[model samples]
Target: MTHRRKTLLRAIAPVAALTLALTACGSDDGDDSGDKKNDKSSSESSDTSGSDDGDDATDEPTEEAPANTGDLPLGQAASEEKEIKRGDGTLKAKITADKVDTGENADLTAAGFSADKVKGKYPVYAYFTYEITEQTGEISPGTDLNSTTAVLDAEGKPGSRFIAIGGQPLKGGCPEKDRELEWKKGTKATLCTTFLMDEGKEPTKLAYGMVNPLLWAVK
Candidate 1:
């Protein structure tokens, strides 16, 4: 009876030792899986934080306003004559005389212009004498004294129609010529135009072109 009991106890002890070893192995695997999960969560959190910072760094900046550099004021007469150069620096112009005159003057009549052609009641006229020079190229004449050349009031508004006197000869004044006069390189000519203004309106400047630099104020 004692021998039988000893054999059974030995067999039961081996089985119990095997069960304990299996349980220990399972516990270690569970701990490893938990550690892997924690590491993955930490990495994902860091990636999300980095992505947010990158978005902020790539944000667009605000725009600024343009600076106001030196520019001539409107209606202020220049102390001396001002020269305007063309974009290609080939043509140059200077305002020789700019003044207000009556449309009934002898120069207008002698040039074959009647008072009926003048639009305003008082028949005030704004005359501009421009001396243009072709520095490099041949510029077509009579093109510079067209409708674009206008007399502007103090508010920068253009005056009425240009006085046309079909290239007629005048007494003691420049002839009113309608034909195109071509200027070769290094040559110059005097061009003139007369604009009709409203009654009691005074011309403050001459707008030779669309730009402000081409505007010449009266003295």
Candidate 2:
């Protein structure tokens, strides 16, 4: 086990002991005030400790940076904050990115996903969305055109290990081969996806999607 795990376990025993001891002391006869005070103190302590435990469990570890990633993968300039569902066992994904790179001509900070939702064991899913500039000539985003809402499963690189059930189809790849966007560009959409983590009840992940404005609608 990691040192951090060991420390958490060690702390648990002491917390339990302290709680039991105080609880027992409070149960003893008529020193009513003392008992009440002990109970109050115990409850407060537990609450604080509970918060710490929750923080520890929810804290995600750092992972490797994206491969072939652009500091910014959007064009013009924009910033958005949204939430989505993802992960192997049900989790909300908070996504945020800049529309333009700090100082790179063809680089834009595109909105994307960093997830761990997969079919098999210990699988991870992460991807980015580009609202492309919609190039005209040899100026392909490969040349030039902001690359507005580019595509998804670009060549199934990592593979469609995770399928998006509720969200509309991403633009670039097969442009609405699945469903059309709500409008054209600059629209918002919500995606209610149920991630299948284990043989459990609730879905593993849930997230809102803002892509292919042409397909995704406010509904």
Q: Which numbered prediction scores highest in lDDT against the true structure?
A: 1
Model 2, 144: alpha-carbon shift in Å? Answer: 23
- Give the total clashing residue pairs for model 1: 2
State how far residue 175 of model 2 sits from its true place (Å).
18
Q: 162-189, model 1: which lDDT tens digit per residue?
A: 3221323323332344334543444344
Model 2: how far is 78 from its true place, Å? 14
What does candidate 2's lDDT look like per residue over 174-216, in tens digits?
Answer: 1111122221224332211111112122211111121311111
Off by over 4 Å in 1: 1-100, 104-119, 122-142, 163-174, 178-180
Best by TM-score: 1
What Cα-based lDDT does every candidate model obtain? 0.32, 0.18
lDDT of 2 at 181: 23
Local error of candidate 2 at 163, Å?
4.8
* Number of backbone collisions per candidate: 2, 34
